[model samples]
Target: MQAEAGNRSGLTLSVPMDLRQLRYFVAVAEELHFGRAAKRLSITQPPLSFNIRQLEASLGMELLRRTTREVALTEAGKVIYREALKLLALARDAEEQARRAANGEAGAVHIGFVGSSFLTRLASDIRGFAAARPEVEVVLYELSSYEQIDALQRGQIDIGIVHPRVMPSGIASRVMHREAFACLLPETHTLARQEAIDLQQLRHDDFVLFPRDFSPGYYDKILSLCLEAGFTPHIRHKVRNMLTIATLVSHEFGVSLVPASLGKVRLPNLVCRPIAHAANPSDLRGIWRQDEAQPAVLALLECLAASPA
Candidate 1:
């Protein structure tokens, strides 16, 4: 302690403590053992003891009751220990807030989508989102509608573009577009001459279809349409994705049912014809974990909703 002399009187003055000393003192106070506190701080026992002594001397108070048999905190030490924890937490929070502001939209976002997402209008939607929010870094992963739902709940993905048939129980969805079913045929096929062909007529012919597990809704939709036409689909070959199915149809593997978006693809030996039996087309929707007040995700949803079907 230092004595400050004034014209009126003399008063004892104590040094103002720094954060490092408070941290060291708190660690030792909590552990109640020099060796353990040193281990916790990844420092040697000698340095830990020296730091604690310096902290006590600076505070002008004995913070810990030390003995050969035991170590414990004095009453004053307990008060400082509790306050130090809160101070450390607040300090960390402030640092994080500053970093977040400096980095702008620096957090990572996980994006999940249907298999044909990259090939369809979803590509344009993604490009538009990237243009608008270039600072938001996104990690894109291709997933089925069901898998997308699971990922969202598990906090695996932040956004999803999926088919409408999949129920999004805890998530929010925005209708991006509906991809109408189209008939894929060989250029020389009779149905290619017509503007559209009845889905029923093709039920008798061998067809290429997506695997049931990969796209249960899409697979079942086709099967149900065939059944409504008074026949079971003659699914001769099963493929994993739209491109593969389109390739097989181009090689005259069989006639296939596909989304109108597939028409964008130019296959030398194949033509895409609209299905006359389609009453209401399948919907392509954007799914996201619901946020009552997330401006960024809301902006993305608005973009998707305004896009063409």
Candidate 2:
């Protein structure tokens, strides 16, 4: 058996009045005169009267008691007038929200980034974006390249600033060449005095490097650079973050290779020197799901483009 709408929903609902009719009704109810309401609505009195009568007929009630001299709302009309005002306000709010979303001036963008990205201009660029776009919220998450990939594939984040490589197929990306490679060492290390050192020079040193599982391509790139220098490194520790590696190096745990940008960071006891053989590599790549190229994401990308890598 067919069920009544109110019974099915477990809540009584009034007639589904359209916004135009409700707007006309509210204007007349507030002004209490057909001539003033028509002027406010930029229409003539005849159509306004017709819509008010139609609304009354649909609801099966006398909304207004009128004569040639003045118009006044009946008791039932006063109640619906308040409710109609509320409904009209909600409709206007919905339209404004929709327009803002389409223009990319509202909504939120969730971003996932590796820790090392903060060492470059990209960090300041992001801060600039937040400042300029006050309406679009920016949600940030610190994650490894692996975690960023998982989040991207699962639709957990809107953008991922990754390292070493871009995400897999079906994802979009922008390569941002952020930094050149550098060797990290304790300030007292024998080779620390030189501003530039060849990769082969540190083949014998124990290495503190980012873990392979955290970023496989980056891990392999370091290894291949070592092989090109003609020796395998003696890895002393595998860590997840650049700061941790710097902390370990400061304690004289081992010599390490990191981005030259890291030298700009305040690691009290650590030092950085350019790797002679380490050519420029894009330290960060912005990745996101192709399907999720939303306005907020695009706005962020536009801001990212202005900052120097």
Candidate 3:
């Protein structure tokens, strides 16, 4: 719509030409016959002819030459016709991009996850979502449950796959996975042959546990469970990552309790046995901000909901 003066006809920035007019001109120019163009546009010839006349007046030039038996494009008409096609194509692309963005088919989503989530069905869910929405950019980060909560509140991540905790105000959550805590032991340990081991039976064994600072709430929950069983666990080693804790237990460093889902994996030198009469642990889940529900994030949440817990 910017101004370019005195080059061609009376066409100027102030003339206020519209897409409909450009479409009409292109149709007439391509067909080189007003009757055919009017039929194609699903309009009567009189109105089509009038619109063309108005277009030519605005441009201050004769765009089409009409004889009793034929019609043809003038030199000025040829130039404008080529540029009009490009403009119309760009306009269509602009509309399509806007629509795709609104529908959540194109954009980026940031997800933060705890390491333990990968051992469960969460990995498959992430893969499925990425495959289904190729246009959506998926960004991932590994963080602790506490770290994820901080990231969500500070607007650093859109969603968090984390351990259960007390959600702060303005946060939303859904339990995407749940599993009872199982006793992790060395494959060669005496308890490995048993279907289940009593929690009190391990009172003399050292424990590999997460540090209280990793998640004070979860740490306290584990302690409360052990205390209920009539004993205080002697923590021999503390680790931050769940996978490392499993590895440590596999190497015969100490005994530990873990999610039952981890028992699905047949790790070398490791055996997961249920703790008889043990209380259920808090569930692993997905969390996000309630006030800022972006479409891309919602689409990912749907994928998580459909995944096996």
lDDT score for candidate 1 against the true structure: 0.75
The runs of at least 3 residues in candidate 1 whose Cα sits more than 4 Å from the true structure, single-residue gaps closed, are 1-106, 166-168, 291-295
Write out the backbone clash pairs for model 3: none
- lDDT by residue for model 2 (113-185), tens: 9988888888888888788778889899999888888898988888888886645798888776467778899
Q: Give lDDT tens digits, candidate 1, residues 116-193.
A: 767687787778776766766668888878888899888888778876665656788767777778889988776789
Q: After superposition, how far is residue 156 of candidate 1 from its true place, in Å?
A: 1.9
Clashing residue pairs, candidate 2? none
Every candidate's CA RMSD: 14.3, 4.5, 3.2
**Model 3, 281: alpha-carbon shift in Å?**
3.8
Runs in model 2 lying further than 4 Å from the true structure: 1-13, 131-137, 227-231
Candidate 2 scores a C-alpha RMSD against the true structure in Å of: 4.5
| Candidate rank order under TM-score | 3, 2, 1
